[model samples]
Each structure stands twice: as C-alpha cells, then as structure tokens.
Target: MSKRIDPDNRRRYFIVGSVILEIVTPVFRQRLEKDYKSKGVGCLQDFINSKPVIHILFHLRHTNIKCCVDSTNCRNRRKLPLNYSQWDLLYTENPGPPKHHCHCLYTTNNVKLDDLDVTLASLILLNCCNLTPNEEISIKELREFKNNYLSHNIKGAITEKEYQTLWNDLMTYVLQLDPSKQDDFIRIQNRPLDDSLCNKYFVCLLDIHKKLEEISDKLESSTAEILTAINGQSNMELLTKLEEILQYVRCQSPKEKTDNHGIKQQTPIQPYKLGQPIVTLHHQINLTSVVNTSWKVTDISMMDDGRLVMCLPVQSRLLICNTDGSQVESIHVQGYPWYAAAVNNSTVAVTLWGIKCIEMYDINNKLKLKFISLPGIMRLDSGITAINNKIVVGGENRLHIIDYQTGKVIQTITTKCNPGRLHGSGDRILYCDNINSNKMYWYSYTNARHHNLTLPSPPWDMTILQNGSLYVVCKDGSVQHVSSDGKQYKPVKTLQTTPGCDGIHYNLTQRKLMTIQNKNRLVTVYNEI
Candidate 1:
C-alpha cells in the first residue's frame, strides 16, 4: 500500500477591498452565511460568532479582505465554539477624514499538554552566557522542585509534567527573592525575557504581585465573600494606584550610554547593505518530534544587565540558554505564546491567547502587569516592536501605538494592509503586505502620509540602519534598501531568503541583522555588505 503524501498545502493569498472586490461566489456566501445573524463592514465579532469556519478579514491600502476557510470539522465549530476574529490593521487608508480612514494567536491550534510537566522551568539557570546568573542557578535546580514537569518533542505541544514543575519552581523562586530582586525576577520568568520591554515592566511587576495575591485570597474564600471583597476593591482604581510607582521608572534606552539629554545614545550608522544570502521560511505544520528544539543560533537579545541573551523558540515556549547553547538554564513562558519583544534589558512582553491579552514580565518570568486585551483579532504570525518609549503593534489594518508612560493607547494610525514584518525607528513605521502582490510601504506617523512609494513583491520584514536607512526582507528571502521616507526603494544590491522567509531585527550597536530565515528555528546573524 502507498502512503498518503500531503499535497493540499495552500499558499496563495489574495487582496480584496472597496476597489478590487473579489467575485464572492454567491453560492459560497449562501452556504457559509446562512447563519449570518449580523453583518456590516469592519471586524464584527457578533457577526463572526454566528458563523462557523476559519474566517480571516484582511483590509488593504484601498480594499477589504473577508476570506473564510471552511471549518475542518463543521461539527467542531458548534461543539467547541472556537471563533476567530480580525481587526483594522490592513483595512483602508485613513485621510488626515470625513475622509480616508480605516479600521480593524495561539492555543486551540497548539499542543494541549495534560499536566504542567511539560514546563521547563530549569532553563533559567541554563543561561551559560551569564545573561541571568540568578536564573541559570534556578534552571539548574529546577529538577529538584517536587513539581517539575518534562516537555516532549512533538511540535506545538509541551509535556505537562515539565510545565507543572516549571511553575512550581517559579512560585518557589518568587517566594525566595528579596522584595526588590524578587519583583524583577518574578516578572521576567513569567514573560519573554527580551531587552526591549517598555518602561512599564518593573512597575507592572509590582502590580501583578499585588493583584495576584488578592485574587489568590479571593479564590480560597467562599464565593460570596470573594465577591464582596472584589466589590470593595473596585472602589480603588488600578491605574491611579500605579501612578507613583510609574513615576520612578525611567525610559531606559537601547543604546550603550546615556546622553546629556538624559536618553541613551543611539548607535551610529555604518555604510553598507544587507548582502545576498539565501534565507528560507519554515512553515511546516504537524511536525513530529520527541522534542523539537530551535536553539540553532539565529536568536538574539541582550539581558537587563546588558549581557547577550541566547534564546531559542521551541513551539510556544522560549528557552534562554547561555551563549554556548549548552546547559539549559531557564525556560520561561507557560503556554503556546505567539510573539515577544524586550522593553529593556530587565523586562519583556508576551501575548497569552487563552486570556487574549499582552503582559509584561521581569527576568524571573513573574507577571508584572497585564495590559490591553488584543481586542480579539485573528490571524497568526503578527508582529510587535518597541522603540524609545512608543510601541508599534500589528493588528489587521491598523498600527496600534501604545504609550507606556500612561499605560494607554496614544494613537492608532491606519495602514495599507495586513502587515508582515513591522519595524519602527525615530518616528517612521515600515511594513510589508505579508502575502499580497509583495509590496512594501512606509508610513510617516509623524506626518501621516503614505509616502506614495512602493516596493516590488510583498516584503517579509524590515529594519532601520544607524544612518536611518531602511532594510526590507523580501519574499524571496532577500534584503533591500530604501530611502528613509520610503520614496526610493531599490533592491539592496544583493540579499536573499529562500525555502521560506520569516522575521527580522537590526542591532545598531553591533552592526548586525538578526533573522530567522528557513524555519524560524535557526537565527542568522549577518554583517553589513
């Protein structure tokens, strides 16, 4: 008998909008929208809930995309109530309008571990690079924790035992830190330990401790008593309570030194371009392995103390090992997290799908604070980046701007379409069409103009050089250079990504571009051309 080969992989992506609306087959709409209890434009949860199937809404420069994939199992849709949502990141352009305006991960699809044993809390101490001395020791002793769990090799799945042990060790570790140090360690262990976390990490860490304790006490009490306590606490506002702590934290720059202006000095630009290198994108699903590890060297990050942090993406969890990639120290994160970005050396942010929110954590993986619900959008493989104190977050058709100081949404600028690789520097945002005609455009958030320039073939991602030059990752696994304003985007003499291309980041100080080319498993570090 012959074995069945997978030949039905669909990779074609199309764009539809107010202008080039696709020929929506009436039969298709009739069959799919029979249960359409509500309808309109813009992402509507109410309308989507009424239907079943994987529905993705894409809003483009001058169009709108409503692509619905039939539920793998129509029955599962009814039984599980698993609904997908999209927002306004790729909707239509916004006029600066009674005018051009615009609009709107994880989990259920990830491995479902039965116990917390799959948690690898031991990675904290495994950081051989000395990124986190305290964490390295914790990971080493993780096996000693009575509740430690073990993770398996299956893709997208974690071993439940490892998860439990990891959390137990985390709980124990937080209990042992001195108030100040404990606070920092707690948040880091709980979230991704990236160096670019916004300034809110430390402040949020303290808030989480307070809130979690309150919730724990409430849970241990009777329902009525808990409700009463909750009501009383409601009298006090969360934002107001955090004001004083927020004031003490400063916006730590990503640079190596501080300037007279009180900000960290950004690295100077070097003259060169992203050289030609064949990069690939790994998007294989149902990958079978006893323990598929992704520590194959392309990951890059610095510690809160300013040391290099070597990281690997294993399924939903990130294993932060030392520079040598030996002695697994501390593996932070509990579930299948989607993406992460460092606020600073000491803090990072993670998105938890089950909860539909993004949280900030300290180096020890302790929850510092939970902010902004994803507003519930669908579409996996999105992006988030923090520059200075402002943040550029990818939604469906909008680039959500977050102000960490006040912990609020400062502004949500409209975009052209579903953004692929998102990078922001100074005051500009550069993004690609993810999977369209393969185009890239720049948004001068400061001026609110689309720059009227475009790149060839949709781009994969982009980053800015020290001289403020733009570098774009193309669909073919290559990098190109563009004018700062995106007016002149010409292929960077030579650069390429093959097999499949994913994400990218640029380190100004080191003059390096870190990226995950083929599988997002191997991180590649490249010097200027």
Candidate 2:
C-alpha cells in the first residue's frame, strides 16, 4: 500500500543520478589529476599519499575557513581545531589516535575516481582546485543545479518541458568541462529507467537529502560564531558578509510548503522603482568595420543565451553578435528587416518593412522556419513582440495577435494611433508610435483597457527589466525609465547621437543595457550601477 512513483519523477531521478556519477565525477577526477600533475605532484594518487595533511590544511587556508566547533568536541570527534581551520562537512580525520590522525577529504591514502560524488567533487573544484574560465563557469553552474533544483525537488519530479530545458543546460555545462564525454552523457540520458534502476536512483536521492539536511544543520549551528568573527568590520563589509551567509543558509533550507490545491505559492518579485539613475558605460562596439557605414540597425532584441539580434533594414539582413559584440554573423532575409524579437532560446521573429509578413527564423541553424501572413494588414515595421506563445504584430492603426504555431490571427485591437514598436510581458503589452504621437500606450489583455504615458519625445524602442519597470530609448537622444503601471516616469540616460536613438535592449540576466546610436553605426552598452 505505497504510492506509485510518477514516470516523470523516475526519469528525473535517473538523470540526476547518472549525471552526477557518470559525468560529473569523472570530469572532476580528470581535472584534479591534471591540476596536480602540472604542480609537479606526479599524479593525484601520489599527491594524496605523500601529503594528506598538507593537502587538507592548504585548502582550508586557501578558502579562509575557520572551525567554530568547541575544542572538547573537536578532540572527541577527531576534528581539526580553530587554529588549523576546518570545513567539517568537507574533510574528516583518519582512524587513529586523535593526536596523530591526519585530516583528508579527497580520499583516504588512495585516489579512486569512482569513489567521488557530486558534492565532494564540486567542493574540491570550487574550494581547492585550479580551473580555467570555462571550467569554472561550468562547475559553478553544476553547483547551482544542486543547490536550487535537486535540493528543493522533494517529489523528484520534472515536467517534459522542464526536463528538456534542464537537459540542454546541463549538457552545455558538461561539454564545457570535457567535450569528449558527450557520447557518454547522451547514452545516460537515453537509458531506460526500469524498476531496478528507479530503486537505485531513489537510494541516491535519499543520500542527497541527508547531505542537504546536514548542511542546513551546520549552517544553523555556526551562524552566531560566524557573525562574531566578522564583528568590528565596516558597516558595508559586515552587511556583505551577513548577506553571503544568509544566501547559503537560505539555499540549504527546505522547500516551501504547498497550498490546499497542492501548488507551491511563490512570493512575487517587487518591481524596481525609478531613482537617481545609476548607469555607467560598459562597452562601445563600432559596427562600421563589420558592415557598410550607411546601413543602420533599426531595432535590437536580446536572445535567451545573451546574444543580441539586430535588424539591418538597408542591408536586408539580421545581424547577430555575442553579448560583447564579438563573433558577428549575418542572416540574409528576403525583404527589409525592420525589427526582430526573440521567440525562444533558438528562434527569432522578424518583421519586414512594407510587407504584411512575420518571418520566424532559427538563429542557431540560420534558416527560416515559417512565415505568418496577415491578410488585412498591408505592411509591418518595428512593431513586434513574442508573448505567451503568440506574436503581436503592429499594423496601420491597430495591433494583431497571431498564434505563432498555427499562424492564425487570434485577437485584434484597434489603436487610436499607429503602433510602431512593441514589448509585452505577462498580461500587459506596451507600445509606442514614433510617427503619430510622443505618447506610449500600455494595453491590458485581461481587462482590455488602455493606459497612456506622455513622454518628452517620440519613443523609438523599449525593453523591460526583471522588476517590470522599463528602459525606453527615445527619439530625442534620451532614455527614460517608467514604472510598471506607466503612472510615473523619469529620464535616466541619454545618448549623444544625431537623428536620435533607434534601438534599445536590456539584458535582465546580465543587468546591462545595449543602445544603438550615431545613426545605428555605434552600439553602446551600459552596466546597471
């Protein structure tokens, strides 16, 4: 009389176990061996056998960790004292007379790649090991996967879409660590999860749960001692230390409880309010070297992977660039490309000028997916955004919502003036008509109402921040900040450009803003201060 495990949960459990055991551990082992060998240690096993105590002490000192456990308990438990420093969860003392015992974490007088687990491997990589930039990013992402996803997933379940997304992200990280193991990972992902395999994975899941609980207990027991250690520091330094401590504590905390309907209720994120603008120039990329000097970037959008998609009307192409404006690639479109919006991680929807068609392209493959033709709308320009699996297209004096999959117009809204540029989030759509008015309009999908906010000049392009507030680039070489509800506004940043700023995009993940200026030949990036 036990509840049956959900199929999705079984798959998730299998993925988690196989990824940690089959991929992560081996990669960590390889890196550790390489790092030690480069330091003249011969091999990892030789290093561990020769200087176990030194190895443990070196890492503790490297990470600036100190043991807070009492001396009496430390002696009884065979733990290091406060002077030698200790990370209780990471290292342990060898079985011997307490005074003569050596502390070790990697392995006890032996090194076996199969003996390493996700937690131990991750700790070693993050705290004690040397890593390249790519390897560092990959390991940190894997750590986040453990802290955020696996620890909180009490049910061991994931939806189909969630599984695909997680698979792609984790695979990317795995390849970054060691590209040769791609086939091994693929086999693990495709392996069938029979009942025996499920049971084994369930045992691994229980062990992870136990480890998480131990982490939480240690954090709770050491908070007071940690705070005391940071006493007398400057207020800013103290606050920063406290915040870091709290962040780790929160990550180790249990998952939130579900409501009556068995759905987890998440606290809504508060929208950022406009204040004295704290923006600084981060980078300026001149596109004149890559493209014709006269060709202009009429619009810009940020993809999920942090790349920028820009519209080149005169060139009739879509220009793609890395987050730093490197690795530039161009896709030729059939007509003049006036605007572009990212539909998903790999897809972008482009609006062609003087054509009543919206072209969806797979940027990764650099090929057109489909064209959605609007019957009544004669032309399309810089007014397009993807929201809730639908594409909102702006035409002469109206907005059309088209189903991206079916290529059918599902809803239409008549506007008082022409809609030029559009952006949407959740149930709201914001648009501006640079030709007809200097006013921006916000439309509610649920209530079917319109709200307007007047600006100093016509708005050319806009992007929303994580908190729902917007950064709007205007026709007067100025950028404005507006509240979520469009009730308040302020001028935040301005560009020194003639013919005004035509394109703008905010990368919420990076907290950076990209704007096109100098007739779209110069691209300026700003960091949020």
Predicted structure with the largest lDDT when compared to the true one = 2
Best by TM-score: 2
The lDDT for every candidate, in the order shown, is 0.41, 0.66
Over 4 Å off, model 1: 1-270, 273-314, 322-334, 352-356, 364-368, 376-381, 405-407, 489-500, 527-529
Predicted candidate 2 versus true structure: per-residue lDDT over 1-529, tens digit per residue:
0135478666776676667655776687788777777878865456545443345443443333332322222222243222221233334454654433323323333444445556556656665567888888998898677656554544555567767778788888988888876765755565554333333344344333343344443444455554554445466543443444344334322233344433332222344557455457777888888887676888888764456788888888999876567767879999998878888766899888988888999775678999987765537554899876678888777888888889989788888667788888666678888774788887876567888888888887787765567778777778788887778888773443565666788764445678887565788877666
Candidate 1 C-alpha lDDT tens digits along 342-440: 676446665443444565655444445546556623245455667666666666777777766455766776777765456666656776656765667
Clashing pairs in 2: none
- Off by more than 4 A, model 2: 1-275, 378-382, 493-499
What lDDT does candidate 1 reach at residue 298? Answer: 25
**Model 1 worst lDDT window (10 residues):** 10-19
- Candidate 2 TM-score versus the reference: 0.53
RMSD of each: 24.0, 19.3
Per-candidate count of clashing residue pairs (backbone under 3 Å):
111, 0
